[model samples]
Target chain A: MKPWWIVVRKEVLESLRDRRTLLSALVMAPLFGPLMFSFSMQTMLKRGLDEQDKPLQVAVMGKEHAPNLVHWLESQGLEDVPAPKDVASIPAAVRDAKPRLVLVIGPDYGKRFRAAKAAGVKVYVDSSDQDSQRDFRRLDQLLQNYSSQTSALRLAARGVDPGIAQPVMLDEIDVSTPASRAQSLLAILSYFLLFSTLIGGMYVAIDATAGERERGSLEPLVSLPVSREALVAGKFVATMAFSGVSLVLTLASFAISLRFVPLESIGMSANLGPKVLTGVFLSLLPFVPLAAALLTLVASFARSFREAQSWMTGALLVPTLPIMVAAMTGMKPTALLMAVPSLSQHFLIARLLRDEAVPLTDGLLSAGGSLLLTGVLLVFVVRLWRREKLLG
Target chain B: MIHVTGLAKRFGTVEAVRDVSFTAPDGRITGLLGPNGAGKSTTLRLLYGALTPDRGEARVDGLLAGPEHTEARRQLGVLPHGAGLYPHLTARENIRYFGELHGMSGATLEKRIDELVAMLELGEAANRKTQGFSQGQKVKVGIARALVHSPRNLILDEPTNGLDVMAIRSLREVLRGLRAAGHCILFSSHVMQEVAALCDDVVIIAGGRVIASGTPEQLREQAGTTTLEDAFVKLLGSETAEVQS
Candidate 1:
């Protein structure tokens, strides 16, 4: 047999024969991406729809100051949650967590709006938690709508047309088509894709290295006609094959899930259009090989089955840092920025989400650079294989 | 078949094998006798190319041993201290695995495996995984795997270190037969009787260097001793001489 062919055949056969390792390699990889995406998107989507539909659940602490404000909030589907007897008693209710939000009225009452000196309503919110922040935001929006409508009516009551009193108004007509939302949704998908590529071949890589050592069969293999570089290369190629399969399956799963999803329910007219999917997928292609090679090199150094697995899982989760940054606040993409691991892909996904044009050069650089790094990693693994201290 | 010259190996600051030199000629059983940590295994590893020496060389059939000298390795067989067979694979599979690595294939591999199974008397345990095999069975399998490839030079490191008395005897018989078959056999051991009974030539190592080398009787006569153990102690100059030096 050709020397590398011997290695490749042995690796593929052994990985398949070992039921646990085979299943872990074949199953967990494809399972993780779809399961994670479906559950996460489902949760976020459900929570979003629920929030818009949930009767705002406004808690009015100072109802006596302006009865009109309370009535206005009711019209917006906000139900007031009665508070403790007095404003001094409000702190205990917040401490006991009886209410998500606490809106206290100042002693000025209706007189402040008449004077316009202190038209401010005190909003005491629990910013310490997720539910609190979300609840506070909805309440804040409800109060703004009330205040703006009240100001307009107040002007009209004074014989001044509200349009005349206000010379200008802020208008934000988002040009982001339905295709854009679909593209932004791809941000999380990019993370999933990136994570899938790095972790998919984890089992195969670990099996090819630590499994061979643990079986006490590595030294003999090392003492073969083949060079250590060839052995590492063969194993690397097998691992990359496993990773590529996962990337493809994950992308396919996303395509299927997005097609059936009701985007309009969330008030997004986004069509996970073919163009956006193609853009995001094309941008991620170069990373797949690099990620597989990098993880394979890392897995090759692990001393045991458990160590290899842990290293693989760690590689997948580490990308979450960049994913979170872009998902939380998508800063503008720059030339140097595309050089970052997931930055360019993320911005690309975001632009496609917002239905904006992306420079073709960014996608090429991201994939090409990733492929180059993979090559360097392959060289490093070859050298490591020659070192005796790492056999385990 | 094996040659060694100044085969010194060191780990960091400590010298594991220092200025060690010897040859186990073809068709002979050469005994390597040493106390614990006396660089016996280190020397064997250097000989088999498992480790690189800080200085000197180990040549099998005129080819130098090192990480890249795999082609040179096909001529040798090794039973590393405990038989480096995978516990998860059956004894048969382990032997076949190593055989394949040594370039045995197809009919040659199957026929050789059968011959080893019969020779090692592992018919019952051959198909059963080595994970729960008794130490004696493991030793037997280790021996079978080392000799199965029909390597001209056989290097065993403390082959009977932990084998039971019966297992030791069985292994001795196998070694005696191999010696008679004219395979160049070099093995290390601390047991003097094993060396006295099995080796035609014995080399005594102390503090990473050879202290005495000769036939067991020659060394015993040179030290005015009746037994190989006594000859080893006298020629190596016991603890007192070591302390004075």
Candidate 2:
């Protein structure tokens, strides 16, 4: 075997036997993302389904003044509950979320209806309250339907066509498929994958560099006939192996866990079947070297194992920045954007999950960009390893 | 044989090694004796190619000893100060790792590891991880690892710093066995008795400069002292007194 390969094999064997490395690389990093993702996604899907299936209840004042309106609301699935005795406390009650929402029909509502004038109704709701806002939307839609129905009746009684009231009706056609609709939520999946990739190689990188130095084995190791470049290459390859394994395990876990989430109930689906999973893994394959090199480079600067661990923890946040920016700006993958490492992988992953074909140029740019940056970082790491101060 | 000629090193404003030169010939043990901070480690580091000297060169078997010279390093085995083993690796595995790195593998590497285990009397501990090994066992493993490659020259920097009495005795026996096999052994120490007992030739350094060089008896005669320890103290005392004046 070559010198670098020998070094790589030793490092891999040593790290594999280490319990801390195994726990982080095999267990914690791979499971944390999928478990948290699936649990939260299931909760979100359940809440959405419940909101649509559950009845909307509202407290009503002056129900007698607008008995017809109340009747229309009940037909539209709004349950009418008795209002509080004091009308002045309605805002406080809404703010306190006692009834969640309150609807008040003014005393003049009946007179206005008889006079064919517009009757005013007040909806008391705290807009800042998320659940109250959802209930308020259902109640508002019911009220609007009642008003339109009454207007149509008035128009028909006057021997005029009620159709004239609605001009230029919007016929909305949804063009998004379930997979495409799910892309927004699954955009976070790329971040998790990238994060776990960095985490997978973290301890290995620190162990090979800072941990070796701290243990005082580095002096003997470096004093061997092997070149510093070979030693560093070996360490980098071992780290990449760990990160790659972690990336694949995380992808598989996500694929299996997403099945239990009721994405279909929310008009979305996770396209994480075998084919998509393989595609995502391939798309993210080039990122392993980049993450390994990045972690190794940062760890080589640390003087001790504890210092390297803290620095690696900070390095874990690097992949998230690009993903966060892409999500916030709604950035689409262009030729230039594809040349950015983590961002390109995010865009490719989102595309793969949406069952869209990744452009060949985009794929090449992403892999090439990540590998080129890896080369640059490897140069820095090798140089750092060659320095006499590396023994520290 | 190992030869170092006029080596000088500077760490920022501190001249860790102002000037150093020494040679340890084959079939003999040479001790680089000095007080702490006397540049013994720095000199060994330069000789082992871990550091570059500012004004001199270290040569092993006629080849320049530096980071760029892999062939020179191939002929040298170095046991550095406070050497540590990988806690997750067994004693045999630790020895085999260095042997493999030196381009030895297969049955040869395994045989060498077995030999080291028996020579050091590692026994069952050779198959177990080094994490909870005693300090003596750890040092034996370190020495075994350094010798696995069977280099012509060996360098040890403060190898007996933390060893107990028995460990030190066993370590001395190991060095004596290597010397009998015609290997050039160079080691550094601040202990006067250790040098007087083990070294065939002694080079005394104080303030990064070689103050005296001879056998223990010769050094005692040169310092006009009855004992080697008294000679060492007198030589260092005069060096400090000269600096003060």
Instruction: Give the root-mean-square deviation of each candidate in angstroms.
Output: 3.5, 2.5
Candidate 1 residue runs with Cα over 4 Å from true position: A17-20, A114-118, A157-161, A164-167, A210-216, A245-264, A267-288, A300-314, A317-364, B239-243
Model 1 over residues A1-392: C-alpha lDDT tens digits?
Answer: 54565566656655666676556556665667667776677678888887777876656766788787777778878788876677777766765667767777765877977676547787766677678788788888777777777778888888888888568888998876665655556556667777776666777788788776776557555644456777887788777777777777776777776655566766664445577668877877777777767777777788888877777777777657766775568556777767666666666666766767777788777666667777888888888887876554
Model 2 spans with C-alpha error above 4 angstroms: A61-67, A80-96, A104-124, A147-168
Per-residue CA lDDT of model 1 for B1-245, tens digit only, reads: 88889988878798889878999988899999989998998888777766778899989888888777876677788887766666656788778766765667899999999998998889888998787888889888988888778988888888887788998888988888888888999999998888988999998998898888888888988889988878888877763387577
Residue pairs with backbone atoms closer than 3 Å in model 2 (clashes): none
Candidate 2 residue lDDT tens string, B1-245: 99988889998898989878888899999999999999999998888888878888889988898877888889999989987799999999899989989999999899988998999889999999999988889888988998998899999998888899998999999999999999999999999889988999999998888888988999999999999999999999998999899
Please report, in order, the local distance difference test score of every candidate based on alpha carbons: 0.76, 0.91
Looking at model 2, residue A261 earns an lDDT score of 88
After TM-score superposition, the amount by which residue B185's alpha carbon in candidate 2 deviates from its true location, in angstroms, is: 1.4
User: Please, what are the lDDT tens digits per residue for candidate 2 over residues A36-138?
Assistant: 9999989988988888988898998889898888887888788877677788888888898889988888899999889998789998999999999989988
- B158 in model 1: Cα distance from truth in Å? 1.9
